[model samples]
Target: MPYFDSERFASLLEKEGFSASQAKAVINALNDVVDESTVNVTDDLITKEEQQKTIERYKNDFRQLKTDIQRMEKNDVEDVKSANERLKADIDKLKKTLQDELIRSQAGVRLDLNLEKGRIRDETVEQHDRLKNTDEKIANEIQALKTQMQGIKMQILRYMIGTITGAGTLVLGYIHFSH
Candidate 1:
């Protein structure tokens, strides 16, 4: 608080043409006003030292929180990397499995084709053998028929010659009897 010399203030007001009693009364009233306007210091307001300590504590807490957040982020990144590696391994396995299945399928198809080809070849050979046997049987039957026809032709020729000879003999006997 600044020093307020009431006597000096009263002297100055008296020099300004106020009476001594009025000057004293004015000084008393000013003192009352000053006293009324002044703020009283109390325990509710904190000291600078206490404020500095609180700020330090808050700074420390903030640093710890930052560290914790960084650690959590690093762990999350590692987990993501592990999961990515597992996915890559699974994809590789699936590709290999698909390739193996394709190979097996192709091999099975090839085996079936080979078996089918063999079966077709056997059937074609059997059909050819049957046709050959049928041709041979037909040839034999044609030869037997030709032989039988030739024997019948020879017998008819011999019978025709014998009848002609008997007719000639009868004519000769008739002429001799008439004579």
Candidate 2:
């Protein structure tokens, strides 16, 4: 709200060659216009303190959001790392099992050959074919597991990137609005 200094305004108008009555008339008219046109706008406007409080609230919220996101990211990464380790352990276990199976198979074939010399050749060939098939199946399974692990890794990377991008956007928004 601005004050209308009618006295000063009338004095100025009189000094500028207006008659005293003319100056008074001009001042009265200006006063009327001011009274009609001006409205009390204080209730509708935000005080600086209120604005500052709002900004502070937003900053706190932003910080909490950032912390939560970071925590989630760390947890997600740890989970992926642990999952990778488990998969590797599983693969190692599978390899050991395959080796054990092969050794057992060889021992069995040898025993059969000793016990049945006449049919030893045919049994050995049959055992060899079965081992080959098992080996192929295991290899294919290992390859499939590897592919699945790769896919999981890629998915985690994409999620991390998207989260980082979202966090960056929030940071930029905070910066823009703070001022």
Candidate 3:
């Protein structure tokens, strides 16, 4: 406790030119003086009333230290609670931020889908219109072809009637002349 290593003390004394025996004797003498002083001081300090007083002082100090420790523990608990509350708040804020971002992305996706649906509907309507126009054109073409076919059929029937009339007239004239 007092930085007195015996070997170091002896070596230091020898370094100062004391022979080994002188060094050992000096160290011994110093030890005896120190021990006597310590004994006298300890005897004075160990009286019954003084010892009781010292014990009472130590007890009081121990109680004070216990109170301080309890106070420090209470303060530490409060600090931990406050830190937890702050951490919870931060987590809640982060959750809200993530939720908001998610909602925004969802809305963006919905908007995109709606726009795509509109475009698809417009294309469908345009294709339907084209189909309708094509159908009407095909119907008109069919009607025109039917009219041309009927006209050609009537011309052929007229030519056949004219040829049959000429043949019947020649047969009648021949029979009358022969009779």
Candidate 4:
């Protein structure tokens, strides 16, 4: 608040060539306006100390939030790592199971193939025996035909000699009778 004296202001105004009554009226009006005026101090304007404390409080809250977020992120990473481990274990077990089944199936197929091969070999052996017997029978028949051919040649030779001797005897008898 500013303090002023009406006497001094009016006296100064009178020295500046104003009439005393005019000076007094002007001073009185000035005083009336001052007294009627008002100055307000609202809470919108903060003190320096209050502003510094609020800034520090906000800084602390931001730091705590950052720590909380980091902790959550670390938990999420651990969860993912553990899940991956479980999945890897499952995949390994599945691979082993599939490999075992494949080995068993292969062994079964091999056993079947060996059995079939043995059966085919037995059939071939039986067929070979039948063909051998047939060949022996044909050989015996050819030998019998050779022996019969030799007997026929001997009988033809004997018949040709007897016919020659009878013709010679008939010629001798005819000559004697004619003479």
Candidate 5:
């Protein structure tokens, strides 16, 4: 079943010449007074609850038919003859109802599947874009870190060279003075 948004319904009612407040009041009343169980099946509108009940009833009938079939298979000749006839009739009725309900349920299933698929696709695209942007930011940060590390390494090398030269000069001066 399609989602029912009260705001959208009210907007539609207002567009049809009802005052905003009046539209809201009417929509509220409609929501309060509508009894799904009391709906007439012959009418064009099938409430969600009614459809669900029908599907459940069909499922139950099908289960009973299966049980009956099992019983017939285990019975004596006389019992089998009578039970088989009843089983056949019950099976036929259950089959017909099940087929009809299956078709109806399939229609709802198809609609739900389409909506879910669209939602999934949209989320996937959004996630892909977010990941791409994040990856680019990380890559830029990594490059900046590499440059800073190289600069720090160069500074350390310069300090080490200066220290080594100063030590060697001091040693030579001491040896020359002692001689």
Candidate 6:
């Protein structure tokens, strides 16, 4: 994956009163945490797929078990009632175990997904804040430059007017004195 520009991010953070090293550390921590959490989600997805396959295989096995139990109840000899009861209890226990495993797997997936989303949200907010601050700083700098340029222009205009007025007065004086 492409890494973010930590130097730039650190500089921005520094502007908000964080020390340079502290800013860098913060950026590094954010990147590490996000990457680690995202990787965890990826792992969770793989585990979830495996769990689903396991559940499917168990479902097939449970079906076969049910068929076997039914056949034993119908055709088996003495203690048929007790055998049926035991088989039913075993099936119920297996179902409960599968259900619990499924719930746990689903919950793990959801928790991982939620953490990934939260990390993304935090990064986005931080980026937006940095961008906003940068924009404001640039705007202020531009305004200051504009003000300085305007002042220079005004001074240049005044100098030009004064020079023209002085020349005109000198010309009129020479003409009057000669005539």
Best by lDDT: 2
Candidate 2 per-residue lDDT, tens place, 1-179, comes to 66768888889998999999999999888778776665445556788999999999999999998888767666766666676677567667866776676677667656654655544455778766665665566567657756866786676677667656765665665556554
Q: How does candidate 5 score on lDDT?
A: 0.66
- Pairs of residues at least 3 apart in sequence or in different chains that clash in candidate 1: none
What lDDT tens digits, residue by residue, belong to model 1 across residues 1-179? 88888899899999999999999999889888777666334345788999999999999998887777667656755665575567557656855775676577557656755665566577887766665565566466556645754675566556556555654554554455335
Task: Compute the lDDT of residue 52 as modeled in candidate 4.
Answer: 95
> Between candidates 1 and 4, which one is better according to lDDT?
1
Top-TM-score structure, candidate number: 1
Off by over 4 Å in 3: 1-45, 120-179
Please list the Cα RMSD from the true structure of every candidate, rounded to 1 decimal place. 49.5, 8.3, 46.0, 49.8, 47.2, 53.9
**Global lDDT for candidate 3?**
0.69
Stretches > 4 Å off in candidate 4:
1-42, 123-179
lDDT at 88, model 2: 66
Clashes of 4: 0
lDDT of 5 by residue, 2-104 (tens): 4679899899998999999999899878776664433544377878999999999999998897677545443533453465567557656855775676577
Model 1 stretches astray by more than 4 angstroms: 2-5, 13-44, 117-179
Lowest lDDT sum, 10 consecutive residues, model 4, at 35-44
> Cα lDDT of model 2 overall?
0.71
Candidate 3 lDDT, tens digit per residue, 1-179?
27678888899999999998999999999999999998888877667998799999999998897777667656755665575567557656855775676577557656755665566577877765665565566566556655755675576556556545654554564456345
Pick the winner on lDDT between candidates 3 and 5: 3
Cα lDDT of model 6 by residue, 63-140, tens digit: 887777556544533354455467557656855775676577557656755665566577877765665565566567
Q: Looking at model 6, report the run of 10 residues with the lowest lDDT sum.
A: 72-81
